[model samples]
Target: MGARHEERRRQIAEALLAIIDLHGLDAVSLRDVAARAEVSLGAVQHYFRSKDEMLLFALDYISERGTERVRRSLGQGEQPPRAVLRDILAELVPADDQRRAELRIATAFTARSLVSPKLADHLRAGYDSLYDVLVLLIRHAQEADEMPAGLDPERTAAALFALAEGLGMQVLIGHRNPRTALAILDEHLDRLSTTAS
Candidate 1:
């Protein structure tokens, strides 16, 4: 019963995402989601009592999907720490149709977060989790001598996260291409390998 309930919620969230992909978030409505999901309007309301509740659930679902994709890409500890970090960071920049759609939704929610404290908190928590993971990866790289010995893990992680996000925005806006953004990230990662002055 629990699994069925969760699956139904996921189906509703996925329908919401599809709607956002095709028509933008502004086009979303309970009736539209119900139609997309092939379910009754009451069913959507049962899972998400309000528009705010539905949007929050959609954001969380997308975030979890992204995290899971990164986990799958990283696999089981075979890759080097720096490589894992690079791959995970690269995932933030959309390189295909699916990723682009995900980015669009994320951008929408981020803008909405500016006016909604609860949404802002959710975004902050997501960033914090990413920052923590990056810091740990940097520490591991330092310990393995893959990165410079004197670099501060936390600061470096923060900078890398900022760079990736900035590059992602640039790519999304067409100010930069995906290849260029990735090359810039690679350059930054290469610099980390050199001894700090």
Candidate 2:
């Protein structure tokens, strides 16, 4: 029963992501998720008391995996400031189908978070953690004089995060080309470098 419960929960999470992927957050409901997962509504209720809770869980799950990826990237090879910066930044961009799906789901959840405390807290935690990574990269750049010392690490980190998320949304919505999104990022980074210097 325990294993079955666990499996049902996994299915529920997968279903939620798929629903968000297809119809966005507004279209997701416990019934929709249950139908998508091929599970009874009661089974989903057993795992998550509400759609909000399930959404939060999915968000946290995505954030945990993303953090691990960023950590692993930073741990590998050379580790030069610029190289690390680019690599870290690259992870945030939705360069592949899987990442694009995640981005789409994240956007849907964020929009739902406006009035839901459960979703808002999850969104806040994810954003804060991702922002911390950006802060670390910006500080590394500062130490190497790749970025200016006087720049506010907080603001700079926020700016970089904004660029990634904004571009991510554009890419997810099919409104922006990946190459052009990258070019936008490069141009933004170039401006930062000049300002930092």
Candidate 3:
């Protein structure tokens, strides 16, 4: 795609994400996205054949953005094991406006994914990618003797992934205070570092 076309699609996708963040997925329509994006309905339709297409594009866009941010924070093999885990888990929390906005879409899309297999696939892809990275990180920590001997990387990664997702939901719904959620995350990381050797 040309630069102009890519920019237009990104603009539309960002608008779609904003709408989902503000009014829930049910409020999403081509007109709403176009208005939010400050583009015309014809422009939205020009890029997305339908709402699902638009949503998938937005999910992919947000996932890439979220992944990039985490990678950047973790840096290139320099961060300590505990800090790496902390950064990954902390990124899942809605600590700031951008994370809160992204969490809104993630929460809404998770519900929609229950009945939409295509959406579920995209969601699963994002989660699985993160899980794989977490597994690798845990394994590295094991090789460095940070985690306990004989600890299972995949199992631990899965648990941490589940914990992060659950923490995000709890924080988003205000069921759990953000600080408390982060405290719980830190506690878990501390446990990881001090597990019986």
Model 3: how far residue 195 lies from native, Å: 0.8
lDDT by residue (tens digit), candidate 2, 102-161: 777677677889988867876888778878878887898889988788888889889888
| lDDT pick, better of 1 and 2 | 1
Candidate 3, pairs of clashing residues: none
Candidate 3: which stretches are off by over 4 Å?
A: 75-77
Which candidate tops TM-score?
Answer: 1
- Candidate 1 achieves a global lDDT of 0.87
For each candidate, the alpha-carbon lDDT, in order, equals 0.87, 0.78, 0.82
TM-score of each: 0.92, 0.75, 0.87
Query: Model 1 misses residue 176 by how many Å?
Result: 1.3
Span of ten consecutive residues with least summed lDDT in model 2: 82-91
Q: Which parts of model 1 have CA positions greater than 4 angstroms off?
A: none
- Write the residue-wise lDDT of candidate 1 on 65-154 in tens digits: 887888898888777899889988998888877777888888998898899998889889989998999999998988888998799999
**How far in Å is the alpha carbon of 197 misplaced in model 3?**
5.0
lDDT of 3 by residue, 43-134 (tens): 99987777567767776787778778878987787887757877887889888788888888777777778989988898888888888889
Candidate 1 global TM-score: 0.92
Candidate 1 lDDT score at position 193: 76
